[model samples]
Target: MHNPPRILAVDDVAENLEIVFVRLQAHGYEIITAADGEEGLARAREQKPDLILLDIMMPKLDGISVLRELKHDESLGFIPVILLTAKADRADVVAGLDAGADDYLTKPFDQSALVARVRSMLRIKALHDLVQDQAEKLAEQTKELAAFNATLEARVSEQVGEIQRMSRLKRFLSPQIADVVAASGDAQSLLESHRREVTVLFCDLRGFTAFTETAEPEEVMRVLNDYHEALGELIDRYEATLERFAGDGMLILFNDPLPCDKHTERAVRMALDMQATIKAHASVWRKRGHELGFGIGIALGFATLGRIGFSRRFDYSAVGSVTNLASRLCDEAKSGQIIIQTRAFHAVEGLFEARELEPMTLKGFRRPVEAFEILGAMKQEEKSAEA
Candidate 1:
């Protein structure tokens, strides 16, 4: 429901107040009457009328004085004021206008002219209120936009920090493991010492030590770089965690930071891929009068794994019998061959074709370790039938 506009009429004569009340009320305006300037000022403050019809020559506090006071007050300054005076003298009119009177009416007022003046002032008041309301809303919207921008900046900073942390982790860990750590939002937990069953793969070139002894330093470095690059691509493709790479030797782990159901099979496939990739490089090395061959050894067992080194430098590594066993097997393997311990062999027995080798004594083991030589991955049909 909309409320009608309120008008405050100030006059000393009872007849004038009655006439204004009847005229404005007939036009759907709520009229409030005041007997004097002081009463008018009090009512104007209390009622907060939209317009004031103030008369000159009031007994206490004249119309001009009331106009001056209202214009000075912050709360009532914006309300429209029409000076109603019987004096037709131009000096009196100028005084009222100078005192902030918005409009004026002289002597006996015509009912039509009075209503028109009231309507005009009411329209002006409505426009002022609308402009004020819009200004407030715009201020609120500006504050909300500022808050949203602040939140967006904070989120962007947090994401950038996470990306930097992930990049640093990828330097020492595999891309797959680095992503896992970043998504979990907890790198410290992964670095904590723990034991879990993991497949360990150790690979290196045969006769690399001898080649390095006689080859130029630059030639040796070029060969090592080429060898590492080829093997590095295969490691990333299989999502294996690279533990370390020293010259021609490299160590990889599977199913530790990121769990894989077919860890042994993945290791075997990666080894075969590595062999195929190195074969091309080997041809080039031989043409250059260099002899080089690749060998790999794989084993599966529970081992303690954690970050090793100071804060400035660190590595994710595993330590247990499994690691030692894999290293010993790689040492015993001939060129172009993949060796597997009994445990790894049993895990992927049907997935790959392997030949059983006689139990051999290995370093750090009291008994001979049963081992097998992996020939290659079986065909899809053979693997399906075995499954």
Candidate 2:
């Protein structure tokens, strides 16, 4: 429902105000009257009228002053005004117009002319109001679109970061374990310092240092690449976490970051598979005048594990004597031998045939540590027949 346009008429002369109030009201506008400029401005502010008819020579405040005040206030500036004066002087008319009067009449104004002028100003106000409404709606829509785009950008960034983390993790972890770590999304907590009874396996090429010293750089990398590829597949197949690899050696861990039942058996089985695979690779390399053999050490002991290294390079490493024992066992193993720590050997005694070696004094230990050399896995028929 559209409300009628309101008009405010201000004049000290009661007859003039009465004439405008009656005339515009008869023409269907809601009319209000004020006795002087002060009252006019107050009514204009209160009602926010569509048009104002102001008398130029009022006592308290005059038309020009009221017009200037209305135009100065942004809230009231759009309302149109017409100056009513008794004098027909050109100078007086110019002053009123310069002070923002829309139109003026001398002594008296024709009711029809006054009504026509009001209608014209009302049309202009309607157009301005429509533009303002549309601008507000458009601004609101722009804000919504910006918010949606920001959310989309954040989600895209998160997905991209996930893909990158998976790529980096796959380089060191098996695909299944990599998936678990990547999905967890909290590498910090997963890699935090903790202690667990893990099976630690340390292995290296038997004569890698001599080979690297004599062989060309290209030949050395080619041999290392071949050695890594064959054993890497076996490590992943057994779902072992590779702690670190340097040159021709690797430190593999079991029951860490992710846990498994009988981790010692798992580590021993992977070692047996690694020895067999390297045996085949060593045969082919021997034909090319390069001799290489692989040995591994498996131990079951408690070790502190966590992420270690600088920002650019990080290793999920195990620290303490358990890792040292495994490395020392590897150092003692002859070519093609899979040495096992005494504690670890007891876990897999039924699955594989291993000979207990005499206690050997190893570095970083107070007493001689008992060890065993694994020969091979017992055949299924042999296991069943023995059972």
The TM-scores of all predictions, comma-separated, are 0.75, 0.73
Give the per-residue Cα lDDT of candidate 2 at 279: 94
In candidate 2, position 304 carries an lDDT of: 92
Task: Put down candidate 1 lDDT per residue, 1-387, tens digits, no spaces.
Answer: 016998999999999999999989998989999999999999999998999999988998999999999999998747999999998989889999999999999969888999999889888989988888898899999899999899999999988988877777786667877888888877888777898999999999998999999999999999998998888888878888888888898989998776778998999999999988898999999999899999999999999998888967777889999999999999999999999999899998888899999998998999999999999988999988877
User: Which of the numbered candidates is closest to the native, going by highest lDDT?
Assistant: 1
User: What are the lDDT figures for the candidates, one per model?
Assistant: 0.90, 0.87
Question: Ten-residue segment with the worst summed lDDT in candidate 2?
Answer: 1-10
- Model 1 off-target regions past 4 Å? 1-4, 18-30, 60-65, 68-77, 88-100, 103-124, 165-188, 206-233, 246-248, 280-292, 308-315, 356-370, 378-387
Using TM-score, give the best candidate's number. Answer: 1
| RMSD in Å for all candidates | 4.5, 4.8
Clashing pairs in 1: none
User: What's model 1's lDDT at 191?
Assistant: 71
Across residues 98-148, which tens digit of lDDT does each residue of candidate 2 receive? 999888877777777877777887787777777777888889988988998
Cα lDDT for residue 356, candidate 2: 91
In order of listing, the candidates' clash counts read 0, 0
